[model samples]
Target: MVLAGRLRVYLIALWIVGSGSNIVNAAGPVAETSTATIVENVSYQNITALPWREADHRFNYGPQSLQFGGLWLPESASADNPAPLVIFVHGGCWLSAYDIRHSYPLSTALADSGFAVWSIEYRRSGDPGGGWPGSLEDVIAGISHIRQLQDFSVDLERVVLTGHSAGGHLALLAAQHNDLPSLDAVVGLAAITDISEYALGDNGCQKAAAGFMGGSSLQAPAAYEQAQISVDKLPSTVSLLHGEQDSIVPLTQSDGFEHHRLPRAGHFDWLHPQTPAYRLLINRLEHYLPEHTP
Candidate 1:
């Protein structure tokens, strides 16, 4: 734990220096207080192609044209019923090669279970912080877009955020910054929460992760330190889900995070299922989200 903290400090310094050239372009603005930071007059659409015909939503925010679109599934059992909302984030180690499609099954399942779902895509580094703070910024921008759609069958207060793999990290960041009345809970599925552990992977995965992060802990300390994805800053009701046998992102990251901060955890739940991690993720989610209950 001490090593992690020390490493975090070192990484933070590197994040500041190595990422100095890009920090201004990363997160558009430092959130003074967690509020629904909106990026308006933007377009949201079905940008996915071919066999899947998935929707990839986009919106213009700050300097960059934020991509990694979204698929919004609205509640349809009745018109008057404003259903709960769940935002799904796709994980691809924050690389360009991976997009939101990987999470379609989970998104669709949640939506079919009666929740208004938003499966989101965001810019990735193809290596580390996954485009520095751009990935994080995109998350903020996407949720803000959804929040503005008041006429939609979305219940702001009951909003839930979930993501798998690298996306799990992004989802945690979103939930932490979501001080909005609509925000409810956050769920991470086999998340690479402890990014410093990228050294544990094979050469390819290691290169992909480190390259995305902009180098190793010794090289890009600032980015790692600036990375707010860890449990050190997680929200009150955060849930960390890990596959007991997960080889991609070891269950140890989740365990380490919980070990570091166990007291502040009021509503936090960490469960490794005898079943798939996804089932456990959904099960925990169902208990908190009313729409998913029955």
Candidate 2:
């Protein structure tokens, strides 16, 4: 287990840079952060610096211009032996400022690690058909459309939905609806669960929550109520992961939910494959969906 785990770090680091960065203590289970440190930082730019692969194919799920997804398949994937799917949704404070390109590295890394990945692109708060429930509707439609795609080699039975930041908020909301397609689990990475509370925060990302909702919690109480999510209502199968050092979405955003908190990780750490936080994410995926066999 140590050998395989350490090898992944080498492979991903080599791809990021000929850096060959090695994790010092990569044996046995990941160290238990029995009493983890909780920090806060504002810098968020790691994955943006790395070279990432483009998706193998792009498919549109709806007539709207922004409703589409990029599909990445592992080299070993074939019609006879399909790979389990990980549907990725990105976060840009629910705005069009941050698109799906930044997440390519994540999808690419996951594909290289032997899973089929689909990084979804949806209309954002700034777009015509985006904002509020519409952005979420697109995510639901995009996930459901995977059932109709005839080109990809994926095991629909072994699927997981995961999103970051605003996208994570959408994923969690979609999971609550009965219409969403079947999934092994739903993962929220630094998700903003309480719209009203988050809007009160000072960060740019936190302030943008109102724009996505079209008004402040007090201005649009109904919208905030409709969008709010509580841990008590979520299924045990849904997993939450957050970086205690996250600057954008506070770790308190994950409060009430059973989660894995990476003490040393920051917000963007989840996107960079080389970070220990990313390792925990991979471990979570493996726990939820193992390799598919023909």
Candidate 3:
């Protein structure tokens, strides 16, 4: 096993901590169980800046340099006692500007909670052979390679596929394919489900849909059609997690699909270990792939 490129260590539990002191007032109606105060500790810059542990191991699914992924096993994990696996995809509007490193905090948090996380690094829009089918293909290869993953200890039966933002879109696209092995669940954190509509938005991220897709929906109708998700074709177990306060990708993106929203959370709150949104996500994951105790 290769040593982590960054510091590799265990993370502490991030349960609900602040009660009255840290609570921030959300403008609109709060969700049923919103612990909004947790948003204080989570933001794109905040999460990426946190002192997080790197993956425990690294492997390449393809020859491309960007085709590699990192694995983070839980403390109790071993070949004799395999931990469940979570395949992670990070989102940066499908741009090369954002890399897999930003998602380490989330992976580290999941590993600490007893799941083995494999965060994939695929080529992005600005990179050669990246964007559209290439980006999606890399993600598919990363997930499919797990069937042949060796040395690392993981429960294949309990595997889940998940991604954030653009990554979520790819996760859903990949899971819907017939070639992939059966998965326990697929979760999207603030995923951009409707790409055609997203491409028209004025926000910088929304406009990036064109960059990743090669053009506006009008210019590349086929790519847009292929990239847009069909909710009916989704897996038996799927969850769309959106943050109401998310300005990067609007909560409306989750419309027409069954989803859960965090009232006080911004997009990055879902990745921050200390946030209530993150806690709820871990709870949802447990429900989908409960720790196998024999």
Best by lDDT: 3
The sequence of per-residue lDDT tens digits that candidate 2 reaches over residues 220-251 is: 99999999986656656888899888777888
Clash counts for the predictions, in order: 25, 0, 0
TM-score: which is higher, 2 or 3?
A: 3
lDDT of 2: 0.77
C-alpha positional error of residue 18 in candidate 1 after TM-score superposition, expressed in Å: 27
- The ten-residue window of minimal lDDT in model 2 covers 2-11
Return the candidate ranking by TM-score, descending.
3, 2, 1
Query: Where's the lowest-lDDT run of ten residues in candidate 1?
Result: 1-10
Each model's lDDT comes to 0.53, 0.77, 0.80
Instruction: Give residue 293's error in model 1 in angstroms.
Output: 12
Error of 2 at 37 (Å): 22
lDDT of each residue in 186-215, candidate 1, tens digit only: 777666666777544664444566766667
Question: How big is the positional error of residue 89 in model 1, measured in Å on the Cα after superposition?
Answer: 1.1
Which lDDT value does model 3 have at 24? 28
Cα-based TM-score, every candidate: 0.67, 0.84, 0.86
Candidate 3 C-alpha lDDT tens digits along 16-45 = 111112222222221122123445326555
Please identify model 1 stretches exceeding 4 Å from their true place: 1-68, 74-77, 126-130, 178-182, 228-232, 257-276, 291-294
Measured by TM-score, how close is model 2 to the native structure? Answer: 0.84
Cα RMSDs, all models: 15.3, 8.8, 8.8
